[model samples]
Target: MAQERRRRPARGHRRAAAPRPPEPGPVLELEVERIAHGGVAVARHEGRVVFVADAIPGERVAAQVVDAGRERFWRAETVSVLRASPDRREHAWPEASVDRAPEQRAGGAEFGHIAMTRQRELKAEVLRDALHRMGGVETGAAVEPVDPSLAPGVDPEAGTGWRTRVRLHVAPDGTVGPYAARSHTVVPVASLPLAVAGIQAVAPLTRKLEGAAAVDLVAPAEGAAQLIVRSAGDRRSSRGEPPTIIERVGVRRFTVDRDGFWQVHVGAAATLTSAVQDLVDPDRFDPAADNQDLYGGVGLLAAAVGDRFGANVRITTVEADARATEHAGANLADWVGARAVTARVDRYLDELVAAPDAATRGLTGATVVLDPPRSGAGRAVVDRIAALRPAQVVYVACDPVALARDVGLFRAHGYELEALRAFDLFPDTHHVEAVARLAAIV
Candidate 1:
């Protein structure tokens, strides 16, 4: 064999004089420091911070990079666990349920590294921590963790039968499901455990919506079993209904549409109503509120204060849509203190600020409530509010980022945060509903 020494494949051979560039690949040795708002594990690798999903602190693990921003930045989900932490052991025995993601099925894999409850804790902690760190609002003072009671007239513990509204995206085949986080893939749900028990009980209704572009399911306290179809391209139904249209809420008595924005959860109507009631004095309302509504759907605030609307409290229920506004008007037309006012909130707010005459559009010593879009108080609206300078303003917010920023802006504009309340309406998710009481310091 010495006569023919075989030559190697020349692998691992390097040109002696020329250097090669460093390889770009996943880094697994980063030290996780804290949790992010969206359940991502935040860690510092070398001199840069890395965000990894499904990762817990103090656990050394490998992550495959799925997204990269620029130099010294990347995000990954946990791929392999080299060492386990305390959290990894808590799920030695998990209660079997249909609420699980597909990856948790038999022989199915993905979240084997962590449990669901831990995920909830992580999401909550991140929310609390961000307020302390970024907003300078300490967790203890900014939000005292209250063992929040779910809305009255509902189930607890398991958090079942709590949803009244849901927005499910439909696939090409009309499979209705929630959009996977950061992805459009429909994570097929066998049964949504989060929806109100009534909604969960309606298996036939969901199957009927199989061909909708998207389905907006609404079940108010009373009414029919109605579903809204959202077809982007070619969604069809065996029942011969148009994809884009208003159907009904709570047993088909009341109807809503794609343009109308309702509370995401059924239980929220009660929770939000209570939040507003925490601010509205009973004296400001009247008894004949059947005709008087707070203007918005179901009049969450109105219903909460319905007993007190006798003192001529007809509020102009303002909305842009003729249909929803009409529907609301008809629903509330009987109330002596409530009237459906159709128009953009911005214009209504502007005109109100300019009211009592056109000379100075200045608002002074007024009382107002703001439930604007997620953009929060825009500069124009804020400027008008400042110019009008109300006495007391109640602000309802669903996004804490915008809430904090607006609170900071309002504080700068001489409004103090008198009282703040946060609700865990959408449990098992990072979203929160908050109310802030701001009084103009004049």
Candidate 2:
């Protein structure tokens, strides 16, 4: 037996509905104000700061908002140029141009649209600004290109075909290419304009590599380019033996793990090595002192010291990567006094700090060369290094703000910036490599 139900009048009947979320604002018309760190142009819309990609300073552009959740600032990508800057040129890579949807453009070459000269100028501006604002130090340091003589027949100043190492991402569906700008999604690209000819020759740009998470292309200075495909999930190389290659920097040859960390730019190692040589005063360098190369990858900079100070130079290369340390030992074997210690830099510094007076005597006039990663050596490391009371500190930095912050920290510890030189190592990107020489103030 079924209970009888009353029939209700349902024609056009409805209850109050939940309110819809507010729709996103329309495309913004922004006047790009300046170039900021992280390879983006600064702009303002209705008093809110917006970081716009694919744009240059002094340009007006209509941009599509990519992120609006932040209360203080928003993020956008230029869709159309309202007023183009004279520095803007045709992008080096067509797939990374503003003509495409922001999400579809490839990453890596953020400054491809700007003239090469202007690109260096913007990098200089960013570096100077970071130093002034964060480090509280003023400098007229200019970013210069790598010496063309070091890379014969290849014009590094051209700012293209310089990358010796190129990593491409693989999508779940087997598409292979670089990740779209500021995203993890792989956007298949037709070419890699920034990769060296060797890398370009071996790069499988059109291939769909199933089961691969990423592909690493390595073109050592002396060998044919090698391609290593990393499988999905495990992220291990598909090949055996973990390929090693020979990289020639000047007259010396270094044995580097194909997949290990090396300067991506072809001439970067030589450029940095020369810069360090020039910055390190021979009169100040002590072959018998407890000198160090922190974050020493494959003993590149350590070799620079040896080259300048002769084979008997005593220097310890501290590295966290056991493999790189092993290679460093081999690469620096000619310097009988050089040692490669496998240890984290901070931990090594802690040991040095705790050592007895007899063991720490060599540190009195030591020169410490640290090529820290983009984050810089940080406060703890800086403080520890200062505790050692080294005579000189050579810092090779990739991130301007981090370098500036660390520089400020060093200054507080009585280290004065003696010399600073910035290089356009990564020309088509916001990244600039700066070598700063800081000496203990007497």
Candidate 3:
């Protein structure tokens, strides 16, 4: 039976901006300031951010723009550079990193953005701006980019595949693709450049497994990516083992499991892990210390740092969904350090003041690294963390809004923003990974 759809006009909601026809041309020239949330530059045509791909700062290039509404800004691509910036002349993607991986497989080419190295600085600046300008976190000094140490490289800001898993939506036509910018249109590609080498290493596995309802490519448990192509209604694909392939990173490679969580970009995994480690100072995990892993998705942070830090930190790997925590425990079981005690974030955090273990994780310089969902850390969690007054706090935020919100909360707790950094892990999309290190003061 075909699903019936209901049509309701916008009655109470504010109306979207008027739409315009796509500009006809090979490309039109426009001045680009900086890249927006997406990879395109934030150029103003009619006082709005005109996102332009393949364009960069200080360059005036020709672009073909398609009108988007209030939330859906204009779409544009740089066609030609009528005015050139010196940086673009010498700074190109392939030239910088020979293994340059891009969002799409047109081949890892450079956008007009001249200096990717400088892009990191800008991201750090944005953090400070958001904190000082938006969140009033500038009590002492404005937030600066995380020291170069936090950066993945000398540039310290440019990020690439350190992903362990990727969720590529299966289109109606059985075509797997990424959504174009914010648009629902699926943009197909021969292959993704930013995909961890391990994920890419197993493309042949797709040929072996057909009729898969959903293919989940995960770089699980600090090892190579394991491809678990699942089925929606069928039973066969669910039982199969992950494809046999070992993706290596850092110094070692572990056995890939069909079900596991690995950083998608193997190269950037160590950097991210180190950042998490810095957040909690996993080095401080004492055998007698008591801490909790709020979202211990696969226990990567817990196992990586907790084992070294010790079980003294009575750790609770809280996850409302029990299945995920079971896997997390299994993954971390071998570690001699603290283990995850089950707890739900919402309920547990709500009763923190009354909970006995609150003292265990209670302030006294305890560290908490809050990596929440896209929806971001809620008010209760934020308030609890603020009250606990942890000595050091590290936030691995995937979204800018939540990060901005929490920055305000942390500021209230007397935590100063020591380091703020952004990673270009996704390369082409508006999405970027941001890590903020907070230190508590008097």
Ten-residue region with minimum lDDT total, candidate 1: 1-10
Q: After superposition, how far is residue 386 of candidate 1 from its true place, in Å?
A: 2.2
Model 2 C-alpha lDDT per residue in residues 55-123, reported as the tens digit of each score: 999999999887888899998889999999999988888999999988799999899899989999999
lDDT of each: 0.51, 0.84, 0.52
At residue 34, candidate 1 shows an lDDT of 69
* Backbone-clash count (model 2): 0
Clashes of each: 29, 0, 30
Q: How much lDDT does candidate 1 score?
A: 0.51
> RMSD of each candidate?
14.2, 12.6, 8.6
Best by TM-score: 2
Model 1, 49-109: lDDT tens digits are 7887655778876775656656877776555667666766322112112233322321111
Cα displacement (angstroms), candidate 2, residue 125, comes to 0.9
Lowest-scoring 10 consecutive residues by lDDT in candidate 3?
A: 1-10
Better of 2 and 3 by lDDT: 2
> What lDDT does model 3 reach?
0.52
